[model samples]
Target: MSAVRAIEPISRGEFSKMLRRARPPPGWGKSIAVANSGGPDSTCLLYLLHEYFSSDGTPPGNQRNDSTSNSHQKANPRIVSLTVDHGLQSSSADMAARTARFAESLGVEHSTTKIPWGEGVFPPLPAPGAPFEETARRARYRTLFDEMTRLQANALAAGHHLDDQVETGLMRLRLGSSMLGASGMRYCRRWGMGNVIGGLDWAGVEGMRRWIVRPFLGVSKDRILATCEANRLEYVVDKTNFQPEVTLRNAVRHVVKYGKESAQNFPPKLLQDIETIDTALENLPNFDGNLNSGPERLRAFVQEMGREVEAIEKEVDEITHKGRLPSPIGTFLISKEALEGIKDKPLVQRALVLRILRYVSPNPWGSLRAQAKRRSARLEELARCLTTPMSALSKPFSMSSQVLWKPVLKRPKIVKGKSKGKVPAGWIASRQPPDLQNAWGVADRDITEPLLQALEARESEGDGGALDILFDCRFRIRIHLDAIPQAVIDALAAGITNLSIRCDKELYYPSVVLRTPKNELVLNPADNPTPKFPEGIAFAKPVDWVSIEFIRTLGNI
Candidate 1:
């Protein structure tokens, strides 16, 4: 591992130094949203800003300047704590409500932006599966960004501290991240509402806004905890954080649990490595060229960049898990290359993956989720039968969103030679009932594709074939951030689609790797011979319903 093995304590002066370096480009305005989960890290940041304004050395109100000697509060930067209730636990809303009250006392105007409670955002949720966490995080962020717009806040702050940084860095490293991701959390990252896609999440110039800020990013959780204790700051304890099996983050936290180390004792080299990685990342190329392109072109570009990005990917992975800055420049190239590569796809998908998968596949989403293990394997074996194996492998070179969900009929009899089973002809994979969904009904299928000759085409939902497929269904639902109610979740359960139910509080998930139904997990397009999901692990259980947790517990898969 690198010198930045774990979260080390930091003195106020040291934190101050880090903050100064992280200062945003002035004009964030007076109205700010502090995304406080009521955790100590966020609580401490809110308090610190309030205290900064309250201090004697601070300049008079409205005197805005970077100087610590001339600190001032203009319009007092309305410090509102936006607590997102992802309704995974009974205590979730309670914690947020309590946080609002505590924030009110701290003089921070707090508002609970319950992210559209259960059955809120779309694409619906699958039953408890490994995909829940990643899906929920995206939902949570989508809500937060929407709230920032609704609240008209110029800036948004979250509670990511040193430990979070370490975790992120480690995750990025573990995930075949480009070096930029493995650099850990930054005090100020561009916004997809504080996402990796920066401003690329939206297409138009109007969408480019650096509205999110992470004030406590440079500080450690220990310092925040200490600050809370010192100032008598009260916060909720997320029990899941202590549980080792819930997520990789929790597992790592258990591995690098912190003790009572004073901020005065942080290692210099750790700081140095942080700086080095940061600097290297800063110097990497910004992908501004893919300004306009179709999905296919972007896919080709991403794969092309993958070869060039390997060196950095290796280093970030090394540093995150092994804890070492294997090669700074190499790491820089990886992130830079990919960012440049992915700019042409749907802004949301590209940004979502960039911000996250630095840790899943780091490949295009459509391509990653498509295909079966045995099919891909068989395809490879078939390739070996070609006139030139390498040239035949070129068929896999293309990626198409159209191909992502293409339901092809399988000619099993044609492939019976490859397998020991007596296969029937015309057996399509899509036609095979998904084992999991066997219990749940499917829903919202296309009523019609298009009536090219008729004006009524615009009024159609979709073709009858797909609609016929999903006659009726329901899903076990979970909300990343709370807003609506259990009733809505119930309605969805009763009305929507195929599902099984289970709820997990910590959906802090890993990047998704494609797992074919036949037991092949592809690490991502970024890696060679795709790695297996550790320990034969294919899917994770994403809690289906938060409401159920109030009454019972759903154990592991």
Candidate 2:
């Protein structure tokens, strides 16, 4: 690769263009918060945002553009600076104070939050060979998000430049990340209630999705430093960047900066390729020929597969009235006719099997690449078994520890003055298999014992009000004393063993299951009384349950 020319300091016009590219659509509110660490990159970002958004000022490149002055005035966004003092270093407080002072000079509102290390609020340190940096990052974001909520900010901007993107992409590539992960950071994304370290946390209140905009993502770090120099901005330098032994990121940075043959130094073509892959992924089922010509056939294949999946889902819905069964918790029933119809379509059959597995799996959002490979292997095995005739479907088979499928004979239905006919044997998929344990979240860590113990402890503590708990990252369980009858509560207190809870109606993905010591309660009423809550304690109206709020609380636990 030829030597690249040095990038010039970013002008206000250039910054504005970058902002346009990174800005999310309207309704995110005009309030913006900057993640300032008093470092050069973030400090430069704060300065630029101030210059552009300050009501009484004109930015460097906009001073002579008098025709657009009024428009610029109307476009001013409310800016605030948020500083997180991790307190990892002795000088961390000083750095935060400096950041506040700089924000004050720019006339932006500032707030500082210190992670409580001594209070046992933060999570435990990473294990050996684990990413300590990532653990710290999650803590930092959690703190920042708390402040952002107090400020009622809609968008949080970070100074992650082109170099940071390249570093992250290389790191993910090295770690065998999915294609989407290797594509690197997006310019703008909605921070949902997912992992915090991987840039998947909300800005304001939990469950209220917020925007995280990286306007400098297309600009280089050198250009940001140059911008700071050109404007005479004062910023603190983090010495930790030079300590390669402390974190993998610093090691990658060193290699990118000084190593002659380091793969960390992203070539232009490689960067372009990553972007192309990202674009293709984002525009799924829709591909243009102008981009990578090699993926056209692959793209066509996926599109066809998607269509097949949809058709299978529609047929299943029609046969089973939306892919669900009448009885037995966590069961999905498919008519024998529907299965026979798709038997000839091998791809469709595999797709149907995968869908059933996904529906029952507690962690639906498991690693995409791993899940795909597992599904392919399982599908092949299932296809071979399925070819042995309908009789083979009678035996129960495990998809995973948490999921199982079997064929059952359906009794004939009676019509007026006649027998309609015996319904053919159908397939049943369920998560309630005898050997299955309650799996939590995407990691699918077994939390059955811990959860049962927690509930028992809470009950013993005589906590009378509603207690919400997140179970297996799949559902939120709200145990409300007020919602239950006194008789059932007394029974629960009396130590009823083999208790079960069932919902009256099915909750969608990330479903909330209502449970008690004696009866399993669902959101909807069930035809039978065994699994559902007793009629006396049944809720007359649906409760507005917020899953994200439960997850936010779960983070602390």
Candidate 3:
């Protein structure tokens, strides 16, 4: 085969266009943060952002303060640089400090957060392997998110590029990932720690959300290096990246760019270990093809998969919009008509069911690849069951902590002796109620801490602030801080900690309640949905503070 041709370096105009297409949330215009590690990719991104913001008349961080400029005219968002120092290497601190200095030189705000690895926060790092890589990454992102929230930024940017996307797709393919899973990283997405709960208004939230934008996903790594070189910028190189034994990603990088002979560069014992891993992976049933084939072919394959994923997502949105019923307090409803429409196409049906299950699941679907596959198979079965006639419907079943009930059809009127055919409504699905005898199958989640955290964030943003909190991982409750009664605010501030949401046993819907440390009730919606309390603690007039909704699809929130 002929050698691959070298690509041209990215021009400044092209980089600008890519940034425009990155599509950071509109709220990010007020303040945005970047994850800068003092590497070539990040360093170039920092410089370009500074340049991009500066090119538009006024520089970033210079919000107009004169009387002539109104609040809306302060369009240049403040740029913040965040560095997570893992301290895995001796030079980690120094690298972070250098990055801070570089950012400050460009008038960008900077902060460094040190991960307390092995210090009770995160467990001691395991020996160099795939597990170590995953652990380290989790620690790094957790720190970054904490800092971003405290700083009140809107979004965090990462330096992931097209090469990283190709590597991720290849790795997923080797591990037997689903087609949608193998599409690799998204250009803009919610934080992975939180599962994909879609459909939230982007404007009203306080502080930085769990969003990470990747403008460079379509830009090649070589272009990043070229950008840094052409502008005469210096960056640090992490030497450990060259050592393949440290992580699977490093090993894959070697195999993709170099050949199998790259393993010979390691010591005799290490070389043997690399070959063993390669053999094991190749023996897997779903290992698609040889990674030794150049990166170009792998890049093309991921692009095609990405197109297919987009097409599937579009179909999902269409069916969901046309036939979805407005979700009640704790249940998800899909019209029987919708299911009947897609009855013959099992692929679309399976995709729709998987999305609904993920949205209503009480537990987050973290890196559980095997369990996800099993659940996918079960979801496919449920999808097929939707096509069964109402007369043949089976008993209610449970999956992912939610109960899929038999279809609820509108009954015929009894005015006439002869009955009319049944009216089609929809299938109702709900969370499994907690059962004392069946401890293993019980479903319960206490969202007190998350609620408290959100309230604190709202307090920091002052009055009239709005934010959405996920209750029991099922309901999206949008809280308007200004509309909350002063009594509830005082109760929270006075050290009452037990805030909870419970479903009515008979009605099977949700209600809000607050209690003291000993579980003594402070406030209960059941006492009166709108009651007057002592100290003139009446429910705010026309209370529109809290609005609840349910997710219908898998997209960015």
Residue lDDT tens for model 3, 1-557: 99987655666676666766665656465667899999988888888877776654343345545666454565666788999998777798999999999998998889988887676456775554335566677678767877777887767888888888877875665554556666788877655334323312111122224567888888778878878888888888898787786666787777768867776777565565456545544553444555565677656766777677778777888877787887654456888788888888765776677666554444443213212343546666777777665542345666543454556777668665876657657777766665532322223344556655766887787656665665545445565667767776677766665555544443234344456555433233332233222232223223456565543224422
Q: After superposition, how far is residue 259 of candidate 1 from its true place, in Å?
A: 14
Residue 79 in model 2: lDDT: 90
The numbered model that scores best in lDDT is 3
Please list the Cα RMSD from the true structure of every candidate, rounded to 1 decimal place: 20.7, 11.2, 7.3
Candidate 2 lDDT at 269 equals 48
Q: How far is 246's C-alpha from truth in model 1 (Å)?
A: 0.8
Candidate 1 lDDT, 1-557, residue by residue in tens: 66764443444556556555555565556667777777777777777766654454233344436554433434445666777887656798899898889888977666786555444333354354443666567666666666776777777777776557655654454544443335555566445212222221221111234356676654456667877787788887888777645565655454444321211233454333333433433443543222123223323333344333444444333323332112211111112223233234222222222222221121221122222111333333322222121211123222321111111122234454574443211100111122233223222122112111121332264432210110101111122223323443343334432222211111211122222334422221232122222355344332221221111001000
lDDT of each: 0.41, 0.57, 0.64
**Every model's TM-score:** 0.43, 0.54, 0.74
Model 2 misplacement above 4 A: 1-6, 24-26, 55-77, 123-132, 194-208, 260-557
What is the descending TM-score order?
Answer: 3, 2, 1
Model 3 steric clash pairs = none
RMSD of 3: 7.3
Candidate 2 or 3, higher TM-score?
3
